[model samples]
Target: MNALQLSGLITAVATAGIVVIGLPLAWLLARRSFPGDVVFETLILLPLVLPPSVVGYYLLIALGDAGPLTSAGVHLLFTWQGAALASTVVGLPLMVKSAKAAIASVDPALENAARVCGSGEWEVFSRITLPLAQRGIAAGTVLGAARAFGEFGATLMVAGSIPGRTQTMPLAIYDAVQAGRYGDAHSLVLLTSVLAFFSLLAVARLEQAGATTPAHGAPAGGV
Candidate 1:
């Protein structure tokens, strides 16, 4: 596949990975305060503060030939899957942080009411918490997908720039620039910029909706 198609696929996989991992973790952080909470959260969010190249180097070591996954006979080195993994790692912090804030904003009393009505934990979450917090979670998801779409340094280190395989848009742009293909580089950059702009705009609109919509009030039909 070409760079655009490859990026879309990687972003989809990365988004799914983050949602599976991040949602439960975000709920735990927002609902419970355990020992070492700060440490655990900081570690989860470290990629946000760390340099992308540094993050990529760490992934390279972990996914390389002699890595633990190799010991388990599950090789991902220099593959498109490796690029998606890198994107997932880097995008997780945004997902968790945004989701946590949204979950925490939900009133505990509302949850208690659901339990009083004989709702199970899963029912309460699905019927009450999720609906209330959907906007912020959506915003986080958009931001995470955006980050995954434009990922470069980490994906380069772990997956390498193999054309038609793992060469995502950012990597393709880098190669174009390096090969003195300014036209290709310019077009790719413009495309990436447009995607990023829309992603942020979506997030902003979600945030505005969340702010204006009352947290304590139920939706029109009620859950």
Candidate 2:
């Protein structure tokens, strides 16, 4: 596939998985504090702070041919799935952090009220907490999707920059530059930039929309 098609597919696939895993993880962090919470949160946020190369190196070891997963015969090197997995790792923290803040801002009293009104734990969360925090969660999801689109270093290390299968937008740009195809590189850069710019704009808009909500009040219909 060309860069445009490959990028879209990679972003869509990785983002879908990230949201599925991220939302509930975010909720867990927001609503409860378990043993080792800080430690787990720290691990999640490490990719944000650590050098991309460092993260890539670890992933390479974990998933490479000589890696433990390979020992179990689960090889992912030089594959689109590996690329998506790498992107998912980097994007997951943004989703979790953003969604956690959003969910935490929801009115605790509203949740209590829901419980008092015979809503089960799951029902209270599904009907009350999730809806109330959805704006922020949506924004976070966009941000995470954007992060996946920009995956390069770690993805390159783990997935390799194969032209059709593993070459995501950022990897394509890198390849263009390395091959001295300046025009192609420029085009790819512009394409990725435009996409990223709009995604970030959506994130900002979502955050702004979420800001209009009252921290202490329930939504209009019911708690």
Candidate 3:
């Protein structure tokens, strides 16, 4: 695939992975308050507050060929998959936090109502709770995708900006700048900015729509 297409694929895969893992974790954190929950939340969010380079460095030590992961024959550094891994790690916190907020916004009464109606826990979550919070999850997915697309420092440290391979749009832009290819860098920056802006706008619109929609009685799945 071309550079742009490959980067798009990477972002999609990373976002999907983050959503799949982070959503359930977010639900657990949001719905089931427990001891050390705050600590666990903070740990999940560390990547957001920490420097990307620091996260990348740690990933490298864990996943690089010469690192401990090598003993298990798991190599991640300097590959496209490594870039996706870095993106997923950095994006996961955002996804989790957004998902948690979304879940929190869902009324407990709705869930209780479903439970009272003989809905199982899984049924209530899949049918009632998830639909109610779908907007938030959608917003989270968009935000996570945008973050992944723009990720640079960590991806660079672990994946090295190899054009048509490991180089994503952000990395490509940086490389263009470093090479004094101002026009190319400017084009890429503008393109990325536009895409990020539109994705955020779409999420905001979804959130608004969700807020405006009235809740109905439980369907087959409780939603």
Q: For each candidate, how many residue pairs have backbone atoms clashing (under 3 Å)?
A: 0, 0, 1
- Report how far off residue 69 is in candidate 1 (Å): 0.9
Provide the RMSD of all predictions against the true structure, rounded to 1 decimal: 1.8, 2.5, 3.2
Residue 176 local lDDT, model 3: 89
Off by over 4 Å in 3: 66-68, 211-223
lDDT computed for candidate 1? 0.93
Runs in model 1 with CA error above 4 Å? 218-223
Local distance difference test values of all predictions, in order:
0.93, 0.86, 0.87
Candidate 3 local distance difference test against the native? 0.87
Q: Write the per-residue lDDT of candidate 2 for residues 1-223, one digit (tens) a residue.
A: 9867877888888899889998989888889999999898889878887777888899988997688899998888778888888888889889999999989988889999999999999999999998888887898889889998898888888888888888888888888888899999998889888988999888877777666656655367632
TM-score of each: 0.96, 0.92, 0.90
lDDT of 1 by residue, 1-223 (tens): 9999999999999999989999999999999999999899999999999999999999988988788998899888889999999999999999999999999999999999999999999999999889888998998899989999888999999999999999999999999999999999999999999999999999999988777777777467632
Alpha carbon deviation, residue 75, candidate 1 (Å): 0.9
Better of 2 and 3 by TM-score: 2
Candidate 3, clashing residue pairs?
127-223
C-alpha RMSD (angstroms) for model 2: 2.5
